[model samples]
Target: MTARTFQATNPATGQPLAPAFPVTTPQEMEALVAAARGAARAFAASTPTQRADFLNAAAAAIEARADAFVEAAMAEAGLPEPRLRGEVGRTANQLRLFAGVAADGSWVDARIDHADPARKPPKPDVRSLRVPLGPVAVFGASNFPLAFSVAGGDTASALAAGCPVVVKAHPAHPATSKLAAEAIRAAAQQCGLPAGVFGIVYEDGHELGVQLVQHPDIHAVGFTGSRAGGLALVAAAQAREVPIPVYAEMSSVNPSVFTAAALEANGAALAKGLAASISGSGGQLCTQPGLLFVPVGEAGDAFLNDVAAKLDATPACTLLTGGILNAFQKGAAGHLKAAGVQPLTQGAKPDSGAQPQLLSVPIAQFTPELADEVFGPLSVAVRYDRLEEVTPLLAGLEGQLTATLHATDAELDGLADLLHVMGTRAGRLVLNGFPTGVEVGHAMVHGGPFPATSDGGASTSVGSRAITRFARLRAYQDFPDRALPPELQEANPYGIWRLVDGERTR
Candidate 1:
């Protein structure tokens, strides 16, 4: 029988794009997993410098064909040219960032301890360093076709950690995912790496992804999407005979609190900034502030009026997919029906697209449903009587990727308890700023506790630290210096930082 195929739709035009992509069958998926397993040893044995070279090459290849990627993403994702172009750049930069991490040699967290013959119980020499976790299965995200999809942060970090990667191309942007996979494959070939070092499978449904996660040879999984999707993958991975780790970044409302002092000081400015953050990219961002806490007074009323005005001026845009727009509409409708919830203002509503929406509700009537993310240009402002109300409300929120606070310097000291609560509820805290923009760097934390990420915020899906997720520590006890890896050898041939006898040294 012939295999099934699917076409990506142009969300802007409500039409499917040409060049249907063949869906991967169970047989093909098995072969891909087998190939990745076959190449795992050789890929893991490769030197960090070799992996770094491959990563850099991948970045260069992607940049060389960036326009093709941008164009495809624009049509498939219904994103503007500038946003798509920026995403391509961000994807390339992520690869290069991991390249630097791969070359550094310090990320492995090498540690060594010398033998002590004089002790009552003789201590044997022990050296330890991180090693690859073999093959990894990556699920591309629908929203971030580039930055979090194929050849994105997860792929880069896994490759840098010396693991073979098999990407399940997102159905939303198959063409873009295909382009990225090709670039990475070319990089692997150029670096003399095995053919199975990287692979991509096209599929639209959950069966293939569940199969990939359940494969015995696949040691880890990386995912980015909705809460339901992440939890589904997590459950599948857990059900396997020998379960593997699933680093899935899921939902986050990214609540922002506005103190009375801050609202009084810059009500208009805050409103403008908050409106833009909510409306940007049609509010598809994971860190978009979905919930806001504002003082219940003239200042807050003025701020809300300004925000409504700004949102009214914003234009409606095509969402990444029709289903997403439908979900947005449903979620918004549900919010409007909730007790004490009233529509403040909304953007222009087109025949087929998403419009910005602002809703208001009293703090007393705030329910759990109010905090749920709508995944579009929609947010809720909860009016509070005093600053003290925010602490309990923030504490009640689920684990979030970010929690922001807008307060004056003078009020910060008094709001220390609230800030502390925010820290516990979120992975990243922003002061006097919105949470839509996530920086990619050593300090950036893209994962959060619970529903925000599957790992309970223990791991990050961005920045240099992300590589550690694809690795496991191995200890060489009483092994000869010659038999040990270069990073853990007595000679320290890698010349990287290592912990020696509980002391950090070079």
Candidate 2:
């Protein structure tokens, strides 16, 4: 039987791109999983330096082919050249960041305790360290084809943690994913790693994704997409005989609050910034501020008017797919019909692209549907009589990736309770700024509670700590020092950081 094939569509032109990709067959999916499982032990046994070399090599390979990646992403994603180019660099940096983590060898978090012979109940020598969780399955995201897709953070962190990775190429940008996979395979080959150390499967539907998650050999899964998609993968993983962890980054409205004092101080600037943040990238960002809380008064009204003016001037940009545009239109229309919701500004509607929209509603009339993510250049401003009223409303919101507060220094001093509530509701809190830009670093928290991520905000899909999701802790009690992993050995052959007798040491 002939396998069905699919091609990428240029969202800007509504035309199909060349070189259709065939969906992975059931047999092929089984083989890919088997290969990854077969290579797991060898890959896990590899030295941290070896994995680091592979990661660095992969980053370099991607840099060498950066232009090609940006071009393909622009056509398939409808993103501008500069943004796509920056994404290419950001993707490479993510790989290199994990490379540094691998080379350091300290991320394993080794710990040791010496035997105490003097005690009646002698304490035996005990040591522990993190080890790879074997093969991982990754799902590329539609919005971030490079940074969150094949060879993206999830793949980088998993491989850095000494786990083999098999990625399901995102259907939106198969060509770009293929290019990234090629670079990673080349890096694996160059580093003398197994052929199964990295693999990618092409598919346009969810069947292969479900199969990949359910594959017995896949020890963990990494995903970044919608709430429905993340939950689906989470459910599938749980249904397995031995369920694995799914680190899925899903939906977030990323609410922002503006105090009256702050708005009075810089209403126009805040308005401009909010407008840019909302419409940027056609509002596809996970951290896009979908909801805003503004005090009902002259200042708030002026701020909303300025924001509407800015959005009205902003041009309509093509969304990632026709389906996304349609959904955005439907969502916007739904908001307009909701009780007390009024359209603040509506940008010129392009035949194929999304029209930027800003809607306003009173806090009392804010429906749950209004709080839901519309997934395009659309946002809602909820009016409140006083700042205190916003606390209860914010408490009612679902877990968010970020919660931002725009307030003056004096105002912030009085907002302790509000800030505390924001902390509980979101993984990250932004003061006097927007939430669209997520910094990738050691201290960054990209994951959030509940629907924002599947792990109840326990894990992050970005930064150095992301490697921990693909690893498990193991303890050795009274084992020969020579038999222990280098990171956990008495001699500390890796020369990495460790906790010795409850004290941090080398």
How many clashing pairs per prediction, in order?
0, 0
For 1-506, candidate 1 gives per-residue lDDT tens digits of 97899999999888989889999988988888889999999888888799899999999999998999989999899899888888888888999999899898899999999989898899999999999999999999988999999989999999999999999999999999899988998998899998899988899888898888888999999999998999999999999999999999999999999988898999888998999999999899999999999889999999998998998888886788988999898888888889998888854222324778889999999999899988989889999998898899889989999999999999877888998999999999999988987888999998888889999999999888999999999999998888989998878887899999999999
Give the C-alpha miss distance for residue 372 in model 1, angstroms.
1.1
Which lDDT tens digits does candidate 2 get at residues 4-96? Answer: 999999998899998899888988888888889889999999987899999999999999999899888988899999898889889889999
lDDT of each: 0.90, 0.91
What is the TM-score of each predicted model, taking all chains together?
0.98, 0.98
Candidate 1 TM-score, C-alpha based:
0.98
**Model 2: CA > 4 A from native:** 348-353
Q: Residue 15's C-alpha lDDT in candidate 2?
A: 97
- If candidate 2 were superposed on the true structure by all CA atoms, what would the RMSD be? 1.4
User: In candidate 1, residue 58 scores what lDDT?
Assistant: 98
